[model samples]
Structures are given as C-alpha cells and as structure tokens.
Target: MTTKVLICLYENEVCPRFDLTREVLIAVIDRDAAVLKEKEVVLPQASLEMLCQMILTEGIQVVICGGIEEEYYQYLKWKNVKVLDSVIGDCKLVLQRLVQGRLKSGDILVE
Candidate 1:
C-alpha cells in the first residue's frame, strides 16, 4: 500500500528533538516502497501542535523523528500515525532504510 512519510530534519540530518524541529521532509511512496514524491517543508517556528496538524493535513502515515515526547508520540499514535522515534542519521540515509522497510524506532545510523 502506498504511504506518506514525514521526517523531521535539521541541517540535513534527523533533528535531535522533534519539538524543536523547524524543518521537515515529506515523501510519498508506492506499494513497492519506491519514492514517488518528496519535499522539504520549513516552518516559521517550532510548535508541536503545528507539526501534528501538518502531518494529519498532509495525510502522513509514518513519522520519523528523534526525541519525541511521550505525549506527542501517543497523540500521533491515537491519530493512527506510525511513529519511528529516536532515529539518528543523515536524512537521506534514513529515507533509504525506510524505503527498504529496514528502519526501526530507536535506530542510530550515524557513522
């Protein structure tokens, strides 16, 4: 099934804190896991509510982020969004792993 994924970014890397992130990468992928479309979104300010709103409005099915708070994580889950938290790596590399269905929560890929 096709899905939409959002990744919080900071300086081309996974943002260390989801609540503090101001930029995000959103991708649309097909059933075979090929990326169909991708874009970076820059927010004027960091707001957890804004982030959640964007994810829902954009039809994001998956979220890749680092250091997300328990409340926000639960909120996303309640909304039926799959969250992979505590991931640390280059944004591109993270995307690759995600596409391969190999990425998991709490994964650290920094080298």
Candidate 2:
C-alpha cells in the first residue's frame, strides 16, 4: 500500500500557518516508506477552503503543516486524514523524518 502526503510550504520550509500557505508538496510513499513520486503545487491564493478542497480531491492520506486552526484540524481528522500539525522545519528534513516514521505534531526539526 501507498500513502499520499501533502506538506504545506513556504519557500523551502514548512509554512508557518496552514491557512496562509500558497504552495504545497505532495508525495507518494510506499509501504516500506520509499517515496514513489513527488509534486509541488502552487495555489493561486492562500485560502483554507481551497486547501481543504484540494486535500479531499487529491485523496491525500496525511498532511504536514504548521499552525492549523481547530476547525480545520477536526475537519481533516473527521475525514480520516492524519494531520501532523504545528511542525516547524525545512521541507526536506520534514519529509525525511516522515518517511522514517519519526515525525509528529509540534515537532521542530530546525536548529
């Protein structure tokens, strides 16, 4: 099985605020945690509604992001999406940790 994950991005780092993120990195990981594919998406604007819509439409299984509101957090949880919120770090490091199964909410991977 494979899991699809989306990481909200701000330049090369995880966006500080999910609702304000305009770019995102989408990746597909296999059961052994090998990355199968990766894609970066740039939204036309920063909108929580649009983000949520994309998450659902893309069939994303996990989301890695910084600060996220309770409503959106609960919404994703209710939809069976695993959300790793309050994560602060570079996108590359975050992805690596995620693949290693070492990532978690409120994680700070930066020095």
lDDT of 2 by residue, 1-111 (tens): 899999999999999999999999999988797889999999999999999999999999999999999999999999999999999999999998999899999999986
Cα-based lDDT for every prediction: 0.95, 0.96
Runs in model 1 lying further than 4 Å from the true structure? none
The CA-based lDDT of model 2 is what?
Answer: 0.96
lDDT per residue as tens, model 1, 28-48: 988696999999999999998
Which of the numbered candidates is closest to the native, going by highest lDDT? 2
Clash totals for all candidate models: 0, 0
RMSD of each: 0.8, 0.7
The TM-score that candidate 1 achieves is 0.97
